[model samples]
Target: MTALSEYERLEAIGLWRADPQAQRRDVILSLGDASLVISDAKAGSALAHWSLPAMIRCNPGERPAIYAPSDEPGETVELDDEVMIAAIEKVHTIIESHRPHPGRLRSFLIGGVVLCVGAVALFWLPGALVDHAARITPQAKRVEIGRKLLTELSKMAGQPCTSPSGDQALAALSKRLPGHDTIVVLPEALMGARLLPGKLAVIGRNAIEGPDTPEVVAGYLIATEDAAAGQSPLKRMLGDLGPSAALRLLTTGNLPDSGITTYAEQLLRQEPTPPPTDGLLRAFRSAGVSSTPFAYALDPTGETVLGLIEADPFKGQPSPRPVLADAQWVALQDICTGR
Candidate 1:
């Protein structure tokens, strides 16, 4: 309405047609605080009032502009006065800028609730609060958070490599890991494998390249999954975000974007902690994958990974199933090459 203050009570001559079939008649158009009043030119009586915000310009960038109150095709006003046309445009811009966008007001309300909860949680037991939040967090939200982390990680490690054939091979490999749906292959930056929220597992280029077999990549996948099972990825992420952020997420269902980005950058610079050897071996055994290749891949000298080699699950026996078809394995190996 501020846009209309300067032109308050401004009047101009316009041609008004109450209906498409009706003949146009000269009228006096006066600008009110929030409406355009149409008055009969001869009688000087108000004929119609159009809400300024609801007014729609029929033809844009044309001289002698035409307008309608809403979308009604029957009624319209044609004004050749440039001042009136400019004023209408300015008032509409002001009204739109002040109007609340759908969902945006709700988002602000949620953020406010989170801020209040964060203030209270700032003095409570942080660890217990984070655990409660992670336990109750929805799967859909977890996936969204995991995607944010992946986007941040991409900035430092480069985007994930993908190819039509390679994607198929990755999907086939993911079937081996229970509950896992995504296997992100990074060309560089990551030290090994790490599990993300929402059953996503990420592996470094080293896991696929070199003389390693498909079983070796599967071993890493199983290991990361086991590690995540021992420690929930959501809890891990919330812990890294700190208590205030965790409480905000618990109350408002969101964390600060900056925190997620920082955690992703930190992840790239540090190595993921390896899961227990017994647990990793059990996972490999359950999947019918030999641990020998993975053991050597971890340590070429084999001095540190002797237990894995000695207790090789599928040693001296044929693997119950091939990790991937020959062609699939070939494609997976080169997944990070061209792309």
Candidate 2:
């Protein structure tokens, strides 16, 4: 029973086979709630039921369109009837449109429960609603929000530095970090790396151009990732939006455009809090990157970052894997210079 009310009870004659080796037999195909029911033409008894959502059209654009119950190489239905083919296609499209993305179902169910809890807790607690919204927000939705915020941030920080060689170099450096999808090297304004709502990481020009090797940039990336693990970007954003927007998010699952704009401006003006040393050390160890270079870069005196310098992950071990090639590091350094 899908949202396609008009296509319900649609019946058509089709030929079906139980397996690829089996002979084709005539059958009556009836479109039922979220499934296609194939019944024996002679006995009128159900033969096989194929879930519409799992239905795969094989040999598309052919006179006799063939379909399989699923991607598995067995049990196919062939329909030469144009009316039946069109009906199946239409129903499939509708069902696919209504189907939730992979993780959306869980997010929706969890969000529902969290929203109820937040509603009751909002009156007594200050940030319960925003925290709940952040916890329940799906990864897909967070990516959308992150993209929007980045667009706004660009207005202030300027567009990310891009050049043919520089782009390739940046891509090479990004591959060293695990899980980070999009990493942008900003020309100026930013002082360190910051993780956005999605798996987007932005690094300052200094982090890229100032370091002799790509390990410094890698260190910054790892630090930002560790920071995000400690405090999610969505939770920080909700805090910036205040309690009213948080309440609205609890009910509507979105914030106003003005709130996003204001927050984006605020982020451009401020530096993100540094992640704890223990977590950052773990990240460096996991990535097999030395923390000494990044530590010196952060504090040339090495007075404040003594812990990072003293406990370098690959200090006494054999040389770890190179972060990037010599040529790539050179290209990355000149990314903003347009050379």
Candidate 3:
């Protein structure tokens, strides 16, 4: 907001410039009437009406005067000069405050946050609610909803995992995944490796199915298991379930039957869990296997697993023979699918 320039003259009574956007705004000044009125351009709205003579009254100790909304039209108000000046200054201050300014948006943001905090504080927002929510959240709920929504994918179709060669292949792969507590193999049709809440690796026979070597299969399992364990299967499980279900699980040590079934299908299908790249790399480093094969198994896309292929630690190392030989791999390959 700006004041009227000294050189600029307004023909309309006492209208004055408020800013660069507008040279002058409508105003009225009446000297003889002992009162002044400020109105809209069309005089359609009365913004302020003040009495002058009484406003200049001085009866020794004078105090500033104030006005409230009027009940009737053309209501008259009386004030001392000091009071008038104070009132005018206050109005000016208010207008200045209302003027557009840079970074004033902080007031609005602060107000909004204050209101939200007030609402939350007004109500009994449970301190432990967040923790309970984590506990009671269901595992299946961790997965998105709907059919084949990753969480509910139970069955897989495809040829079973063929014995890569024999028990030797299994033994070699087992060596790769030696740290894991349990190894469960499904048919290749099952699609990918799924690590369950326990130290269980759900893999399709196809992981050992095609042209891939036993050590490659072992690399995949070891990586998946390490990823799962690094995150703690139970922690990951609780994280997915959501706060409510997580809270319930923490309290009851169990989830709903539907919750169990919902995720069970996902386990059955072996839809892979995305392994943390860093974790996988670290695990591969620990297992002494090239991550290239597992990376290829996960994403053949050159873009996704290129790094692994390039930096295979076990690139030329002589891998140990598997407990399940190449022949055994063939037998285990289609066990699930043939059924």
The candidate scoring highest on lDDT is 1
The candidate that achieves the highest TM-score relative to the unseen native structure: 1
Residue-wise lDDT of candidate 3 within 1-339, one digit each (tens)? 122233122112334333334455545432223234555556557656554322322222444333222333323233334433443444445556767876668888888999999878555343344445544455453322222222333343432233334334444455556654445565434655665543445566567566355556666677667656556454555455544555565576556656656555545644446566677767777766667666666676857876666766666343443334555555555444434
lDDT of 1 by residue, 1-339 (tens): 444667887889999999989999999999988889999999999989999989999999997899999997878999999888889899988898898797998999999999989876676679888889889999999888888888888888889999999999999988866767798988878867777888777888888887447877877777777776666788888888888888899788998989988888877776766778888888888888888888888888999998888988887244678888889989999898886
Q: What is the per-residue lDDT of model 2 for residues 1-339, given as tens digits with 9 covering 90 to 100? A: 652677677788889999999999999998887788999999999999988888999987887899999898999998987877887888788777777796888899999999988877766565777788888889888888888888777777878888889989877776777666777877767778877787777778989888786778888887777876767888888888887887787788777889989987787687766788987888899888888888888888999998888887787342278888889889888989972
- Compare candidates 1 and 2 on lDDT and give the better one: 1
Tell me the TM-score of model 3.
0.48
- Which candidate model has the greater lDDT, 2 or 3? 2
- Check candidate 1 and list the clashing pairs: none
TM-score of 1: 0.61
**Model 3 regions more than 4 Å off:** 1-176, 226-229, 264-281, 295-306, 320-330
My TM-score estimates for the predictions, one after another, are: 0.61, 0.59, 0.48
Off by over 4 Å in 2: 1-126, 316-319
RMSD of 2: 25.5
Tell me each candidate's RMSD, in Å, in order: 20.2, 25.5, 12.6
**Deviation in Å, model 3, residue 195 alpha carbon:** 0.6
